[model samples]
Target: MTRQKWTTEEQEVWLEERKPAFLIANQKRCAAKSFYPDLVKEFRDKWPVPPVTQAEIDDAGSVELATRVKRDKYDKRTSSWYPNNTRTLSAHGGANEILKIKSQPQPRKLQAWQAYHALTYESKWKPHVNKAWTTYKEEWLAEHPKEKPEKTRLEVMVEFMKGKFNEENDDMKKRCEEYRNPEMQAVLNPAKAKPQAAINEAFQSAINLLPRTLATIGESLVKQTGWNITILAGGPMPDTDGTILTYLSHSGKTKEGDSFDKFLGKKDYDDHVLCPFEKFLHASFSMDGEDDKEKEMDDEEWKKQNSESEENENQTENVDQTKNGNKKSVGGLSEYEKSKAKNIAQLKLVMENLNENYPFPEDLVPKPALKKPAAKKEKKEIQQPVERRASMRNKGGDKDRYVM
Candidate 1:
């Protein structure tokens, strides 16, 4: 049985597809570095060796010539075989190069480049990336101690990228706002706000006044210490009520009786205080400057007292243990007899090594006197104050009172 060649019909279809097929082949050859311009020309010259047109031949002899032309030019050769060629594609040797022309660099969106730059070399972003790297690597290893270094690095990078993008895009800022106080929010609104028009009202009405509130702090510090101080007020002053409450509540000595309300002479400031109008403005703004030094001192004192109380308790426990051991008699032996028996072992060791330096005096010593046991301090349960009876009768212009 003879294998049939492609008919004219099959050949035509193959011919039509040749260009794109050739391009694909060329790409593979180029990737393999076997398809230079010279090599491409040689390949085109060798393979698509176009057939002699039917119009070029005119008779039976020419038809025989065409058959001969097809056989000699394509069918007879095993190299670069395709549709009409007898050789199988898989049997043919592949081009040395498999890739085509260098791929044109893909066009990047501005946002993508911005992100890449932030990742690789941005100075400001480097610190955050470094921080993420340190935290993730340590935590990942701590959680998955047996993981390989290569796997751990990849995992760390994934978590770090997630955190980095969230922080850079202001997601962290939004989260921080959830925990911010109402008074702080009022002052921070302008800083967090966007656009000139939307923020203008919040800015002018609230944020703009922060400096004035801060200035009053400096004024108060000067009044207190008579020395200049640097003020770092980041935002606008609080509202009037917030200001007044802050001043009245926090100003003046924490010790009894020197409160801001009393110092300013709430009822008769016009005569009692020299500068009534200035005091009113200062008090109105609620600008009680922070005294960190005083707070630190108070904390130290509290810690000292707690430490002392702990030491005293430990000492009392030691004293009680000694007293119990001394007074209890075991097997009818007196307290003195028990002490002698305890030292008997040590005395024997001394005798066995007479030449060795003695651990204690030649005379067998008694254990030191047991301390007196501290009296067991009984805790008295506290009694709540008794409620007084309410008077139903209305009295002339007097408010209700209760006795302790």
Candidate 2:
């Protein structure tokens, strides 16, 4: 029997009729190959490639072209291919088509980090990204309402910055209120309220006692100094009768003549007395104006002694130069003079600390005055009132008015 050649229209009709069966067969083959790749490989190895003639090659190429055309037509009609519009497998293709389907390009899902970075940095995409994220969160919550896992990196960053934003908002609100009120302006504006030097002096004074306290009492006690000693010692309790309190009471007298134990239990003596005494000792021994005055006097005495020593040295050198025909030499300050200078420097440091710790009021600060001239002026001013009264009495002929 001879094979019959079909016209173009007839071939199209035939292919359309056979398309469903071809697709069913292709799907079954793909499933089998996917499930049993080893079996497929073994079968291919058993039936290796056969030699092809020129006529066979030509026929195969023509058939492949036709299959491709049919696949394209079917894809265009159904729009069923992937987004790239690329076919992965075909009924007319080989086993490679099945593998292609397995390795088909999937839609690229956004990673958490990538999505977060884009949302944070890309202004254009932020709204859309945030909307999508909000939707995802709503859906996720709906699915797993009760479950709460650790926050993601983006979530943590947002939460941390959120607090900063709130603080900034509060500060802005305060500034706005300050702008509306004239009285609050001076206090609210840090630059205008306190001068930098005053602020620095206050800080220096506050920290001046720190070094001495640390040297005397260690860091632990200094850190815990804020706590009440009664709380540190233990909760409220009655003091023992035969303790150090009794001995101290014997050494000292109380206003009420109460026993030391009773006094200790009644008031917070540790806070009122001991702490203040310690601070006083630290300040007194550390450095003060009295120490500075003493150092200045010592320095003057040292200068006088140094000058005398230099003069004596010069005289001795002159004598030696006359006796041995050697050159005369000048001498430097004595060791005692050098020691005085060092002591003065130490005293000066103390004066600085005193000034910082105990700042004087502007009214109390003493101003330089010419004592003799001021005294004379005050005397003349006082006599003027008396002289005026005397002249008035003499003019009025009232001698008794200005009594002796």
Candidate 3:
């Protein structure tokens, strides 16, 4: 509409007559449907909820002061973790204020951790990791004459293993051939591999064997305290990404076990426990034959290891590129895409609000010529109704609950 300065009388009349108000029910209002109740219920159900008190919330924050205090405490302790050491007991001070999430390892016939770190560790491993490391290191170095690639993790690991086992290297050419074999598939793509043989002998010795290294797969979301709410997620690789589980596995033991689920203590907290996150050094990332530390680390002690690897390893075509990339690619946005998608969503919601009665102006609204918003995919069925399960409080007297 063309604008013209309104006279005082005209402005007064417009204010009195043109202002619009629709007598819509609260249920029909957009604000009513958008958030509040639904979001609140979901948040609360996510349970042992965020600290119930202000003091706990204040204690939970990771201010420079808290970080420094935590660092000093951890520094004084018997460990060499980095500057912001989250593992210190100081870090767990107001922890219950944070919502904790941990991967619950599923009982599996074979876990990669067992296969890779077995006491008979070198048996099935030598054919793959060493060869791939030697091969990739050579080709990568040769191709880039000027650029000295930071040694790949595998290369560093091979060096460590060679010295530890007092093992000698095979010919470089022979190593390359081993790397190329079909059976060495995990060398190229770690997600799939001949995980250590999980035979009965391995299971029998598991308390003594599986290297749930003290290292953590990811950093703790909240480091300055303990947690009240801990959500259990199903880990895809089952303890591969977790810390030393030997003793946790040890405590859960039966005269005959591994056949039973929840045998591992944290596997049910009734149980409890976690790290660098990505920056882990002391913890070995090798897929095979890591040197053993007799004091097998447990869930409670997980958050205490190296913060990161020695360095951010280079990505090469020959390794970890062939299989399973969808692992991290399913989320959207450059904010621009998100802004557009969000705008479209808002427009559709506006259209619903107008709903044939109170229509918005033609040019301002998405025009009839413009394409309609894409239909939303149906939400996946909740095969497991785990909602509200976390919210249930401990009511004291024993009661049987349906897992389903």
Candidate 4:
């Protein structure tokens, strides 16, 4: 099949997708020590390569300067010019400024030369250039026959169709087996080596290939399972969460988010002090003893294992963290404290690496204020001349006393 010419396409589209490939064949024909201005001008006029803009050059210069002047210890250290930068982003640059194009010098955009070339280089010139180039090549080959190699009929040079996988091609399996490498065999399972086209066809076999919306799925589910499921949603309970809750109430309807209520429903919880809030009606995936089990593990060299406090409050949540599948203690720090510390460390590293000169925020670590202990209440000496007992006052303004 003949390749479709880009020049034959619509004027607007071809103009937009303007890519010029010049043949520098004439350069070889020039005299040994002589400069060819006429020859250079001929090709230059036909396939004009425009010079880059001053703005582009300036950007490149700035990038080069920034590269040479990297974030060093002198830039970071507390000096008259450079302040002590602990953590800041502005020292490096904004997200846009840090981009590949902004940080590193980029090649000029197509529009840089398109305006000048599009007006000058017409679509008709493509044919003329192709013809002239072809003629010059033939003439050169004729003049120097030795430059062109003689053709040979090598019997092994048979063309084979290298296209999409055909089931009928029995030779493909043999060829695959012959060229099978250990690396490929280790990576791909032969049992599950069905073609992607087959899988695609199998997946799209359904009558209705259009996406099934939430409502459609819900309807289908209702039909499948004859359960009259009232999708109680909205209010404090997030509707989008898709939480499935099943309950039988002894009283009135349950409130939003929580079903537990004295009047509505009573929850049977093992009476304990400082117990983690366990929702009875919830995903039972974590109800197993695995999550509840906490071992005294000190994996990190710097961090100390939390010695079990006499107070049962330590047994509550936020005791251990499962970060990236590694169950490690948060050094007895709360989530907020852990996040703040992590942020500070990250920012500090960035500051040192990027040579940021922004001043660190003051008073991040709050001062621990001393709390005064409360004084005990002193017992008042209540003495009567004769026998007396503690007197009781009633709401009716009547006083009753027992004789001692």
- Residue range 144-234, candidate 2, lDDT tens digits: 8987534554674455334333545555544554444545544544444567567656554433322222222322222222211111111
Cand. 1 Cα-lDDT: 0.37
Listed per candidate, the RMSD to the true structure in angstroms reads: 39.6, 42.4, 30.3, 32.9
- What lDDT does the true structure give each of the candidates? 0.37, 0.36, 0.32, 0.28
User: Of the pair 1 and 2, which is ahead by lDDT?
Assistant: 1
Error of 1 at 160 (Å): 2.5
Which regions in candidate 2 have their CA more than 4 angstroms from the true location? 1-139, 152-154, 158-404
Better of 1 and 4 by lDDT: 1
TM-score, per-candidate, Cα-based: 0.15, 0.13, 0.15, 0.15
Error of 4 at 204 (Å): 25
Greater-TM-score candidate between 1 and 2: 1
Instruction: Write the residue-wise lDDT of candidate 1 on 68-166 in tens digits.
Output: 665454543322333234233434345223323346476443243234333333444556666766787677788889884444544555556555545
How many pairs of residues collide in each model? 9, 0, 21, 0
Write candidate 4's Cα lDDT for 1-404 as tens digits.
Answer: 84553222353242233211111222443321232333334434553433445564476576444433332222221111111122247545653342221243553343312322222224323354455555655776788866852321121111001111223245644444432443443243454356766654554332111111212333333343322212211111112121221211111112232312322232221111001111222222122332322122244521222122213223323212212122222111111122334544554565354333323224222335324333232112212411132221111211111000
lDDT at 266, model 2: 27
For model 3, what is the C-alpha lDDT against the true structure? 0.32
